[model samples]
Target chain A: MTYCVGLLLDAGMVLLSDTRTNAGLDNIATYRKMFTFEDAGERVITVLTAGSLSVTQTTIARLREAIEDDDATGETSIMLAPTMLKVAEIIGNTLASVREDIDHKMNATKVSVSASMIVAGQRAGGAMRMFLVYPEGNFIEATEDTPFLQIGEHKYGKPILDRVVKPSTSIEDAQKAVLLSMDSTLRSNLSVGMPLDLAVIERDACRVSSRRRIEAKDPDFARMSEAWSNALREGFSQIEL
Target chain B: MTYCVGLLLDAGMVLLSDTRTNAGLDNIATYRKMFTFEDAGERVITVLTAGSLSVTQTTIARLREAIEDDDATGETSIMLAPTMLKVAEIIGNTLASVREDIDHKMNATKVSVSASMIVAGQRAGGAMRMFLVYPEGNFIEATEDTPFLQIGEHKYGKPILDRVVKPSTSIEDAQKAVLLSMDSTLRSNLSVGMPLDLAVIERDACRVSSRRRIEAKDPDFARMSEAWSNALREGFSQIEL
Candidate 1:
């Protein structure tokens, strides 16, 4: 299980991903799902993944292998892709192939080897873009009307985003919104855990602007969670029947 | 689809259910998911159901038929059952039989004829109780540690309930909590809709003390939803990053 969200706002893009993976209660592990590729001042791409660990890990590994290849081209490398849309296409194709390979090996066991990802980034002199890439190699970009995309255990954290997010939201508020969204998810679901990977890519910067890894005991996160809880209780009490 | 919540609080029990049924996006119809039976001052039993409408409707009909039979006995009827636990048992067995009957008839289509229900209420001289009865004729009761049970499209509405609901919450507060919970679900899911049926059973009263049906344009409901949305935005703005 995983919980990952990407916000495409006027100010920038914010991406957050939890690092918990479990096959069962006894087989839980921490595995980072957020991957960042940057050619500072040229392009920055961040991918947040969910679903089968094997598929996502292999897809990321292959994408990296392609990036490091001497003959890496726009056809084989996300970094070399000419546009954000093409970056999504490259990632989606890689994910689809990895999933197919795994499915062929595990098909007789009635298992599904599907994974999904959120691709958020910008290329030099281009617009910032965000997409939800599906297991079938198709993708949907976030729009002004619906400016956020989430995958894996998304419902528990969605109501808040629905209420607070908008295209004009600031980068600071966008960061807070995603954190609170993740807080709600963590409290409600056992499979989604910390430390969280948070990245902010300012519009047109073409580079990672800020990044943080929030652990369970991170003081700022702890304070924010406590303050949000208190605020909710106070707000709930104030609402008249 | 449906969204029904049952809260077992120190003050009493609160049950709310939405009334939307759909075979697909276009085949939607309104069917009451809440059924209440009360021998005023003696006993009250409310059943809130979700999932296979055929199974749930059939189970409720059978339970009613047994109650109306001249030969209805302690073994065949919920009202005559000595304890709330016994009442749950009777309801569970009835639901299981109904589901099994339907499953047999629909076996060739590979469809699941299963349903889930929350049974909530009290009988004179008995403690108030709530149980989530499964399609297999088994059930689990709400406890002090977790005083609420929800079925069908529950995740969207669960975070607030997790944050605010406790066994010691006041009945008025409990009512508000559940309405807000349902409001969240209705906003996030099209399958769960208005109007909603709400019933409250006060501790030791052994009968429904209050009930209301909240339509889409119900003034109180509209006001509450508006207030809640405002409160949430205010809270979000006040939280520090």
Candidate 2:
């Protein structure tokens, strides 16, 4: 299981992803799921993948290959897509093809290998857009009303986002919200673990401005974790029937 | 769908369940999930059921019939059961049987129907105990190290439980913890809705001492809901990245 979140705000976008993946309880390993495509000032897009690692890794490799291919066309690339919507379409198409191919090979064992991706970024002068690409290859964009998207082990972390996020939210505050949200998810579930990758893209900058890896014992996280626990206990104690 | 939670604390046991049930997004209705059986002062057992309402409702009805029988015996009754553990065993066995019965009826359509329950209360001098009965009729007790059990649409509400609940938590605090927990779930999942039911059993009392039904527009819930939103915003602002 994994937990990846992307928030598109007025100030910019924030992306966070955990590093834990498992084939089974005993076969746990850490695999970074956040992938970035940066042409610095030209474009900076971050993709967070979850579900079958094989499908995501293959799709990403194919994407990178497409970007490098001089002959790559709209059918084979997200980089050359005209709009964020087209970029999303290219990603959805790739994810779908990768999943079906993997499913065919794994069908002998009757196993499903569905994967989803959270794609967010800006293209120099373009607006920052965020999308959740579904396992079926369909996709939904973060509108002004929604403003954020989450994938993988999402339920445990959704309440905070539902309550706090908006398109007008500042990038600085968006970072805190995603971290604390991740904090909540990490505490309740063992499958989503630490050494989290966090990236911040200032709107229209076309580049990720800040990137941090929060290790298991990062002090800021420790403070936030303890503070959240205290707030809950105190908040709970103060509520009267 | 529903969200039900049970906590076994030194102060006693707390059981909470939402009343909303839905066959699908368009088919929503209310049906109480918390059922209490008390031969007051002798024993008190509160069962919170989730999943396959048909199976759960039938199982509870059968258990009630056995307890209501005039000449009930250990083989056909819960009232005559020697201990709370035995009561759990009987409930689990009955649940499994009811599920299998329903499964057979649905077999032609290839639909799968299953049920699970959280049973908690005290029996005279026996210690307060709680068990999470699985769909397979197997069960596990809540211990000091892990003193709470949740069933159905649970993840959306579990973070607060992880941060605040403990073995020594008072029944009153546990009650608030669960209500707040369910409130979170209600905000995040459309599948989970309200008119929440909560029951608290004081240690060794052998009956529910306090219970509440919080409706959608209840003033207290609304206040807490707003306060939580404000507090979360405040908390987020106070934290530095």
Most accurate candidate by TM-score:
1
Best-fitting candidate, measured by lDDT? 1
**Residue A235, model 1, lDDT:** 83
Q: Clash pairs of candidate 2?
A: none
Q: iRMS of each prediction in angstroms?
A: 0.7, 1.6
- What DockQ does each candidate score versus the true complex, computed on alpha carbons? 0.82, 0.67
Give a tens-digit lDDT track for model 1, residues B48-144: 9998989998999999999999999888899888888989999999999999999999999988778999999888888888999998999999999
lDDT of 2 by residue, B1-241 (tens): 8899999998888889998888978899999999998889998989999998899999999999988899888767877788889889999999999999999999999989988999997788788889999999999999999999999989988898888889988777787788888889988888788888888898888989888888888998888777777777676666676
Candidate 1's error at A87, in angstroms?
1.0
Model 1 bad stretches (over 4 Å): none
lDDT of 2 by residue, A41-78 (tens): 98888999999999999999989999889998867677
Query: For each candidate, what is the lDDT?
Result: 0.94, 0.88
Question: Which is the leading candidate under DockQ?
Answer: 1
